[model samples]
Target: MSLRRRMCTVAAGAAAAPFVLVMLPAGVANAHGYVSDPPSRQAQCADGTVECGPIQWEPQSVEGPKGLDMCSGGNARFAELDNDHHGWEVTDVASTVEFSWTKTAAHSTRDWQYFIDGDLVAEFDGGNEQPPFSVDHTVDLSDYSGEHTVLAVWNIADTANAFYACTDVNIT
Candidate 1:
């Protein structure tokens, strides 16, 4: 190509660089949601309440296959969440705890499941519809007491993936 043509090409590329950079994140917005209230492990990390790894940067991205029973959702990048002795803050609560979730990229949901000690405590129907930006579920924990880890799962309706978060709590 001629020198003039090369210069024109470079100028055009430079002009579009900013726009390209801005739109780059649009394609990586697949990150969905995570528990924010009662502060799930990922939530604590994201908010700096607890020191964690990459999960601190993208808490809403702890997504993996549905029916998972772990906090990190089987995502190796967030494996720190699976560590139970990582000085995670335990929220003190009564027999009932209302867990709240923040959805960054709201997708259709199949259901929301809460488990403790690997036992299902509550399950809410999502009706295969998109949820609100913030979702809340008042779970009854009257059957159990003392320190416990609550695993909350947001099962996406259309996909086989689910978002997972573990909340440490002292039930009084």
Candidate 2:
């Protein structure tokens, strides 16, 4: 090869090396599990209606501590549709808030459901044969403001379990 061509090849290889090195582990890491917005350890729902930020679903096998135990299985796969409850406390009842997230699994028998203080707020059906899906919802918090707990449950009958990830929860 010509000298100029050889130099260009070497430069190109050097440039690509870092990109590959940076992206490879990320792909593998994401394949296992991940969390988007993690709450602080000292975070408190003292008023009973505290705004808990976004929460991401991850595989159980992934290292590090988790605020919510929303995982089940050896490979840390997402849960199937069933009666599984994950709870969070809301601090301020008067504040309006929005909750959003993504869901991924092999088989989901039915749609997902949202409950606030034991009341059904919404439901979602991603349809059969869909492995990955996402949804976002916003609701007034004036009624649920004080010391109430919110739960997100999957009501898919006959399924084992299911998992969900919260991308963002803005309370204002």
Candidate 3:
């Protein structure tokens, strides 16, 4: 082609590149699931119950390496979840609390685990099968009281990653 035509085409493509990038999704490209009920940190952000950064937009995208104990699944972009004093709303609950997950993208699961103060409180085996749109676990928190953080981990059966969520609760 002509030199002028080639230069014009190159410039046009360069001008459009930025727009294309902006139109694309950001944050975790594979955002999958997060605790919804009792409103985990991300859930609160998604529901506007609390102010957050990028996590506010993609609450279900808190995936990270397996065996992570903190919320945000070890993702720095979502470090806000690791902030214990981030003004996360504390839900009042009974001794028996049901933690639920809202899976935006279902994937084969290994098992679900719940921890309170670094102690394993409850767990459910997934049998290497994909979970439903929502999964619930009835955890007996009668042994603990007052405000506490519950870290829930969803270990995927197919991937070397897990989704993490932290819900603050004041058990009555």
- The clash numbers for all candidates, in the given order, read 0, 13, 0
Candidate 3 local lDDT, 11-67, one digit each (tens): 999999999999987543343999999899999999899999999999999999998
Q: Residue 35 error for model 1, in Å?
A: 0.7
Give TM-scores for every candidate, taking all chains together and pairing residue i with residue i: 0.83, 0.37, 0.81
Best by TM-score: 1
Tally clashing residue pairs in candidate 3: 0
lDDT of 1 by residue, 1-172 (tens): 9999999999999999999998875432354899999999999999999899999889899999998898989999999999999999999999999999998888888999999999999999999887888999999999999999999999988788999999999999
The alpha-carbon deviation from the true structure for residue 95 of candidate 2, after best TM-score superposition, in angstroms, is 5.3
The window of 10 residues in a row where model 1 has the poorest summed lDDT is: 22-31
In candidate 2, stretches whose alpha carbon ends up further than 4 angstroms from where it belongs are 1-96, 104-109, 129-133, 140-142, 155-158, 164-172
Model 2 root mean square deviation, Cα atoms: 10.5
- Which of candidates 1 and 3 is the stronger one according to TM-score? 1
Question: Judged by lDDT against the true structure, how good is candidate 2?
Answer: 0.37
